[model samples]
Target: MPIGILTTDTGKLVEIRETITLNSDAFSNSFHEDLQFHFNNERIPERVVHAKGGGAFGYFEVTHDVSKFTKADVLNGVGKKTEVFVRFSSATEQLGGNDAARDIKGLSVKFYTKEGNWDLLCLSTPVFFFKDPIHFPSFFHAMKRNPKTNLIDFSMRWDFVTKQPESLNGFLYLLSDYGIPNGYRKMDAFAIHTFEINNKHGDKYFVRFNFRTEQGEEALTSAEARAQDPDYYNKDLYNAIEKKNYPIWKLEMDVMTLNDIKRVDYDPFDVTRLWKKGTYTTVPIGCLVLNKNPDNFFRTVELSAGNPGNLVPGIPGPLDNLFRSRRMMYRQTQVHRLKVNHNRIRINEPLYWKVYNRDGRPPVRENMKDAPNYYPNSYNGPVPYIDPARPKERFTIYERNAVDLEPAAYFYNHYLCDEGQRQRLVNNTAQSLVPVSPYLQQRALRLLSLTDPQLGIRVAECLEEALETPTPAPHAIKIPRHPYEGNKHYVHL
Candidate 1:
């Protein structure tokens, strides 16, 4: 067989000598086209959050019969397997940031089910930083770099944490050893929002999804994580898959009936708080096994989009304000970044879909061919399927203005049971707080004290010990004093 000639993006053959310019003219179309093509579209917009991630192809097999709880085909029959693509990411890290950094890990699984694509966007922790979606921007902004200095400022982080006391429970988890997981394979994932699922009888149940790692939970200490490779998590996942040591997670659900929701003392839909233990029964639904690695990172991983709004029958989208906001925000962000036809992308496309949405972006494919794009048409446009099992009742949620500290208090006292775990939490919290300003540190300490006095005391003692040793500043850049520091005639400017 003979080798084919190199061609431009337009498929025009190129001459051997056309690759270089003639004399000093540099007017070759082939050379310019190649250079322009490479230069013009070499990069795509980075994700605003969860920019750094690794993805793998897998299958979720239903190991237990969950048909009694819901009518979802994905969780119905035992031994049923559904193709899945799982992406693990760092919530706050940029594209090239360290995977082992002490940050929230994002675990989103796109299940290519028989009906359509169902995305379960999850986080490493069972609780989130804040409840209301209004604080979403501020929470992420504080977690990210400072605007002026363009650095991770501890004062900025602590300031937000102190002001929003509801964030204490989340911060407690983040400041614990669990914050730095050994790798993505060893960590659990939780759908923090409480979703409502219905049975064939239209019986509704409020449930929380948890994917517990079958590999057993493991974590890296602050020192151990700092010494590992920056892409340790990605490398670990890829290598494990390549070696055929597939990682697996058992899918479980904590279910509460409508009556149980009314009997609960705390808000069931609160993302910042966890349901009290024993209040709901945990049911093992299935197991997810990652058996294959993505062939191309950019195509299979980078371009993949997961939204909480993607749901099949049985499971209805959560009505929580944060979840509702995310349902709109995720799709819009993907549209702005990956275009409106992002779902048309190979990795994100559903196993079966027939929507009336047509045209607007490049990968519109057939654009639903000649079918009508509008509903209620005589030409037989795609119509919504009404599931008889779907719940129709509307429930009222009472709004509360009070700040609850019991969750954090429960986490600190009950969850962090052992002395070693408690000490590690104190050390981790102190390590981050040491760089914060004195006032902000005091405020943080006050917040922690409200959760548990011993937690506050231990952290303060660690800070005191750290201050006694007086380490050098993180950066050596010195600011120039103002020219009119002591001048009485200086203007207000």
Candidate 2:
């Protein structure tokens, strides 16, 4: 039989040209060596976060038949086989860290549906920290180790938290038993956003997704979490699969009508709060079974890509600012981490990728060989996914009219819904700062005051009772060198 090799010269499929070679020739070794050298340099880039993750091959079968809710083809067909790559991650920091750390878990899945790579992004908790987009940089800085100290400072972390008490709700979940789960198998996943479901008729409904584990949620205590090895969660997951105790999660979605949104007391679009489940029932979607594991870790796990941007036909997502940010950021990261061919990577590749994007990093299938690289080409390149039956679904975008951009906006600020978010931040932050120098405590007090006056007073009074001596350089330390800045400008300092 002749060797079957790809022929890219033709617009149509063709076999490789046959060549004759002497098997005994020593020059053949030289040819093989040169080819191996090029092959060795073929590895791709890695993702910054969600870097360490595990995935499996599975199908997202729609049991609810939400076609009336969305034009998304994936959710329309019952028992449809949409090739999916689901990533489970640690939300607090990088993927290199242990699975059982005190952080929110991330659940991102790429569904290779007929519409496109429909990405479903969510978190372990329903709410998030901070609402104003401005705090993102500051919050991320506090989460990381101090540049000079190279250590995770509890003081630094709490310092930012106490200052932005709005993050209290998310922190509540972070500090709870749920924060450090045993493994991916036992953690719950939440979409954490109010999205829209658009049908062929263009009718829209507010929706949220929840993935509850069939195995039940079990978390480790703080002491036990710290005592065990960092890979405890990873090991637990791998072992469970190895033992054939295959784990599954029931996919549930809470949906509300436009009428419900208008009637609700608070903003459902808030990332920090969950729509009351009783107010809106979760219709069963389908089961997510993690049966197969990857053979190669880094290629499949580390460099894999996921974003909330990838949406399918019937499942239309909400139009939230954070959700939009995730979509663009994730795409940009994919370009850097996995190269322009990030989407083409085995793990990120869609089962039936019918689109205009072609030619990047690695060229599989003649790199759409000889086809018109650009759209409107005469050659048979991929075409975009559009319903032959109807128009696309769109949601209303609010650019801030009445609502204050705090509290309900993020995980930390929970005053809008859950009872304990703000108070926890106040107490936890006050206690942490209570032991610090008086000068630092006062600065901290002022920051908390910015959130709410009562919060600041409570924190300051708590510090006063714990009364550490004022540092000798109190005035000098508080005052900065050079010209005074804007709002924080206090020449008095």
Candidate 3:
């Protein structure tokens, strides 16, 4: 094969010496047009959260018929396959951060169905920090580095957790062994917010989706995670795909009918709480298999966008407040980061789409080729297809102002029943809490005590053993008033 000539971005062949100027006087088009232009625009804005991630290309196969629950074509026919792109990320880590950090993992899947793209955004934990979206900013701020010190402050995290009892469930999950997975292949993903699905008969059902790892659950201890490579999970996933050892997850759902919803004692729409174990039926949906890795990590994985609001026909948008807030937040963030025409990016583009949205940025391919951009026009333009099976009425949610800890209590007393697991949880919690102030630590212990006295005692013991100096006496420990204590309707459990 003949060697190709080095050229500028505009395709002008360049001599070797033209790449560099002899003195500062000479102008080199090859250096300016090729090297400088590419270097100046190589990076985009980093995500505020979930910045460290790896993605892959694969397909989702429907293993079972779910037409009765959701008329979504991707889940309707058995053996049907839809091309998919999945991005696995750490929740609070910034760009170039350690992949093995102890944090909530983000598992976002984008299904390229014939109808359009469907984005399912999920986290590693079954429950979230809080139900109300109002607390989102504060919660993230607590998890992030402190503004003053520009360092991760455990005191801030413990303070937030101790004040907002609703965060206990997710806080426990984070401090437990589940916090750090061995790798992305061994982790499970949960769509924490409950979604509404309708069928061809207009039968509505409340559902929570889970992607259980087929490789079985495996996690890394704190020491092991700290010792591992910075890009441990990303490398593990990529190497596994390259070696044809594909990672697979079984898609399942805990489904609840309208009657079941009314019969339940707890609020089903709360993202902070989990649906009771025996209250809902768990049904197998399908399997997600990732067999191919991205050829270009930046173009394919980094550029990919997944938003929860990208729903197909059968599966309507979730009505929960958290989901409602996320629908706007994700789109707005993507627009700010990737621009208005982000959907046109090759990795995020759907199989088929027609809309009145026209040019705003570059890569607006063809701009729909001068088609009728305005709706209600005399020309033959695309029209909306109304589905008769779609539900017309919105699902109603009764509001409550209570901080329920039964979920966390149940998790500790029942789920962490094993002595070894409980001990590990205590040790993990104590290790993180050791750096926090004594007042914040005492408040955290009080919060844990509200969940389970034995768990709190064990963690307190662990903390004392880890600390060199003696901790403040129980009588001397003065906890400040909780932020929500003044609320008349706020019930702390």
lDDT of 3 by residue, 199-266 (tens): 99889998999999999999888989999999999999999999999999999989999999999889
Pairs that collide, model 3: none
Candidate closer to the true structure by lDDT (higher is better), 2 or 3: 3
User: Measured by TM-score, how close is model 2 to the native structure?
Assistant: 0.74
Model 1 per-residue lDDT tens digits across residues 446-470 = 9988888888998999989987887
Whole-model lDDT per candidate = 0.90, 0.67, 0.90
| lDDT ranking, best first | 1, 3, 2
The deviation in Å at residue 142 for candidate 2 is 1.9
TM-score of each: 0.93, 0.74, 0.93
Tens-place lDDT digits, model 2, residues 1-493: 8566533233233322222234555344444444467689766554445555566656676766777667777777778756677777775455567766777778877777765787787788777775566676677678766778876665666677667665655765665555677778888888887777767776767788888889987777666777987777668777887787877888877888778877876778877655654567567777777766778877666767777777765455667777777777778877776678777777777766555666656735447656676877777876655565343434566744343324423433432244444444445455556545666666666655664676668667766665555546545546576564554634763
Candidate 1 — what's its lDDT? 0.90
Residue 87, candidate 3: Cα error in Å is 0.2
CA error at residue 144 for candidate 1, angstroms: 0.5
User: Model 3's lDDT to the true fold?
Assistant: 0.90
lDDT value, residue 402 of candidate 3? 97
